[model samples]
Target: MGYRRLDKHILKAIFHRWIESQSISRIHREEGFDRKTIRSYIELFEAKGLRPGLQMPDEDLDCVLQELLPKNTRGRNKRELLAPYREELLRLVNPDASSGDPESPAERPAEVVRPKTAYLILVEKYRLEVSYETFKLYAREIGLTAQSKRAPTRLESPPGQETQIDYGTVGTLVDHHNGKARRVYAFAAKLSCSRLPFIQFTYTQNKESWMESNIAMVEFYGGVTECLLIDNLKSGVLKPDLWDPQINRGYAEFAEHYRTFIDTARVGKATDKAKIERLIPQARELFRRLKAIHPTWSLDELNRQALLWCRQEYGRAVHGTTGIAPMSLFEEQEQSLLKSLPPVRFEVPRYKPVKVHPDRFFTFEHKRYAMPENCRGQSFIARESGGILRVFDASYRLIRSYPVTEQRVCWLPGDFPKSREALMQGAYPRYLLSRARTLGPAAERLIDGI
Candidate 1:
């Protein structure tokens, strides 16, 4: 069906509404005209120096609009002109030589060339009369695509051979402690063979959370894989490279404890770790479902729900590619193949070497917290774990402990001592002296001596 044409009166109404600062869509609803037609009319009026505030008679307005208004011009038909060269064009675009190995750049046939060159050939040899633009458009109309040079090969690992880890944002959640919503990230790991997966959620993707999640994942699976294929995330890989990837210190310690090697995926290649990489969308969907059930949940509560949902729903379900339930497949074959977990758990805290100031305070998380008096002018290591920030001496013995907070400066009770001279130098010294003198003449004499 064709679009309804707007008359001069309707066109003027729409343009006037637009001139009065009404949106094109709003005018379209009120004036019963398409937005395209509305834009054309407004553009026509502007082209003739006729603004909204300017006064013009109906006759003058019609004259200016009629002169500037666009006419319905139909383009010439080129179907018959190019019909004879359709098969030849297809052949030139996708030659047999190129078809043998489409991905091999070295094997690209000379006849398989650009559209412009093909158009020139048709003009010179076949005496074609169509313009290059029309030819290019028609070329796209047929099924034709540029050949690719790189042919990617699929890689698979044996059972208990490799596991891939990746972090994905699981939307926002409320931190029950602070009563504020913040973005949460999910650390996911999937076995390459059976596709069994494990996930943990955290507020931060820092070194502490990353290492904690890795430990949690291994514990959940009850075994460790020989190799870990992780993405080039800053928490895990300090510097990403095709060879000799620099792993973070904490992550390296965790790997050593688990007796596994860390192999990072190639740069710009998500498919290198496709097992866990493919689980992000699934994880997102699971998070959405959990959110609908419990719209507002703490980070821990959300993760608990995620764990139950994964086991009952995704784990027991039949796999799309392997045609077997992931849990069943994992239990029957991959379970025994995986290496045994360590006897003791790995605890890696957020560590920083800081020099204690003269005031017996150390800077942590961009904030200052009080330390022991003996730690003055000495270098100590600060560690944060389990919501408790602690300072250790050179021998790693815990010297001080304080509750973690986001405050700029925190002072413990009785940290700073008070003295008579220090108090007398205050702004309220006169009032303090008057109150002291009320006790006795001895107080007055002492205050006067000071």
Candidate 2:
């Protein structure tokens, strides 16, 4: 007789009856399974530490059935077919093997051959008859193309200690003013301890937008984390290195203003900021659902909806990994632990390298702002914030500041030479009049009349 394939329900039934202290003969008589089969299942359960009157979870029962069932041997047959070409396959997969000298295997750098490429090579060069799917399967079985099974380390942070931030694209939105479709991106910041997330949608991922989104996230949390783990984006990290990364000037200032540390993830390594990486997909899904409902909504409206979703839907829902609602976790544990917010909100400044004109004026946002006379014909940093354009020397010391205005040119009294100031202000005539008065009354009257 062919072996019977039993479903989970039947196995559960048999296990339940046995747990009730029913005899094997009685179970076979009642359940219609063979006596030997019932005995084997009882023995298997007993070996798994399951005893009579012990409550068996569904998961435990599933494990018992999985071990008891027979595995398919289809992979073994494929492996047998691929065994003859094992050496060739290994040569192809080796990254340092030479293509021209497969037999000798010279040490030369080359791309690791993919499974499909190996399969094609076998079919074309070696005349091996096998399907691509079977070749891939056996390649993994023989460990030629097998992925590493290294388990990832679960990183944990103290409440309010760290947050991970990244940007991900969330479909396009039509601009209200230009009536053109603009690709939108979501800026996501997730607290490492509570798994609480804050998302903002923007049409840009530039330096200003990045700083603004970070500020918004910090304010949303009502505080800041001790450290921020961010991706190596050009807007935040100007140069990415494993040991030392160069952070953007604006972003570094933003971090300083918030009293936090900025840590950049390694290049091409997504696991460095794994928390935010996981949140990105979820955020993208939320935006997808929102877009489906409000296809014609403006960017501002979409952002509002995203915020609402964060609070109501995502925040309230129990997190899969944490097994607690994010909002509840934050409120109960992480909220009080966060670093206190600064007295004033951080203003995102624009940093630019500008050349000072010969007249000691530098152009900022198409408007001319006067720098110190010493700064003329030199390159300096221009920082714009709070309606003031500050010029910084090469040493990053504040040189001077001019009020930002719509006027074509802005200059302070100290920015010009005393003589030039008088000439530009039309004070030369007054000076001549004063000199004439010092000479005689007639000279003073003549200059005044003129």
Candidate 3:
């Protein structure tokens, strides 16, 4: 009969039957094993001082079996091939080992090397002959390598405490007005506690679009969270820092208007605002499905469909992580906790610093607007919104307001100095005549004739 390996459970059953005073032949018949196999196991147990009537504890039996069974050497030959370079492999994986003992510095290189890279280095430099898989297995067995990943800790937030926001690209779509294809992006917002999502699609991801999307999201939810978590997009965050991030001026005003706080995620760290980060992919997939069904949809129509999907499908469907529908959670548990919206919606404005020229004029949107003579050659803040440009002094005091028109030059009567005002108001001819009269009668007559 061929040799067969018996597990601890099988051996324990055989011993139990033998201890019950069953004959070897009967035990073999009942256990479906050859009589010789049963007799051999009994003989081995007897040799180990385990009498037929004596009861052996499970732990003691396991220990006895461990000592009696032959050691598994299936991969012994492969491990022996790597034995010579074990120290080298360990050194490559553990760069800090060299610093532990200062008495004798490690001769091997001290730079940290990944296991796969180390395996390649060993094959190339040291001429070690072993497959990458074999090297990894042996390295793990010898404790030269270990998994660096650990289970991630889930972040929990109170309802209405925070909202996470992000922007993701949804493929290009044709503009209904222009009939030209434009790259489109989806703006996603999610409440941290409810996993409630609000999605908006736009042709641009500029500062204007960013603020507009945020406003629309808040209006859709009919409330605002206490804090807004967002990625370090240039439109929202001017500079990204771990401790002190610089928020965009317009976005700051938007937050202030809604009585909310703006918090930015760390640069390149998606897990900082994982709630919104997780929504982007799902939003993209939803948009793709919408586009597939309505291939000729315009940007506006696409946005309309996306909002409907968020309300009827995405929001109503149970979330994989929360196991609850987002809209249901929001309506049942989160909506009342949020802060109330302002009486009037915020007017999105673009903030820029503009310098008044020596001629008492400043340029905005390629059009020149005249400043007060006293305010000439000074830097002022220009806030443009609702077809109007409002200029503010350094102290944030109102300077002048002008209609953002298509006219090349925008000026008021008081914008110029007293001296220039005369020239601007058609008084230059009279002034010239007066000067000519002072000069000579002939000059005055010549000026009059001209």
- Residue 98 in model 2: shift from native, Å? 45
TM-score per prediction, in order, is 0.49, 0.63, 0.62
Q: How does candidate 2 fare on TM-score?
A: 0.63
Per-residue lDDT tens digits for candidate 1, residues 1-450, read 357765667766776786688888899788777677778777777877878778788888788767664576546487457767666566555665233454566444333444555566667666667887777667767655455444344477888899889999867776889988788788888888888888777889988889989998888888999999999999999899888998986798789989999999998898898778678756765564455445667668878877775676678999877788878888998889888987888878687888889977779889898765666899988887667888788777888888887666766666655443245336456755777788988897788778
The residue-level lDDT of candidate 1 at 142 comes to 68
Deviation in Å, model 3, residue 438 alpha carbon: 10
Q: Which candidate is the best by lDDT?
A: 3
In candidate 2, how many Å is residue 25 off?
7.4
lDDT of 3 by residue, 25-73 (tens): 8887777778877888889989988876897788888888777665664
Order the candidates by TM-score, highest first: 2, 3, 1
* Better by TM-score, candidate 3 or 1: 3
- Winning model by TM-score: 2
Error of 1 at 418 (Å): 23
Q: Tens digit of lDDT per residue, candidate 2, span 318-421? A: 98778999999999999999988889888989999999888777788898877765666999998999998888887899888878777877778666766666
Clashing pairs in 3: none
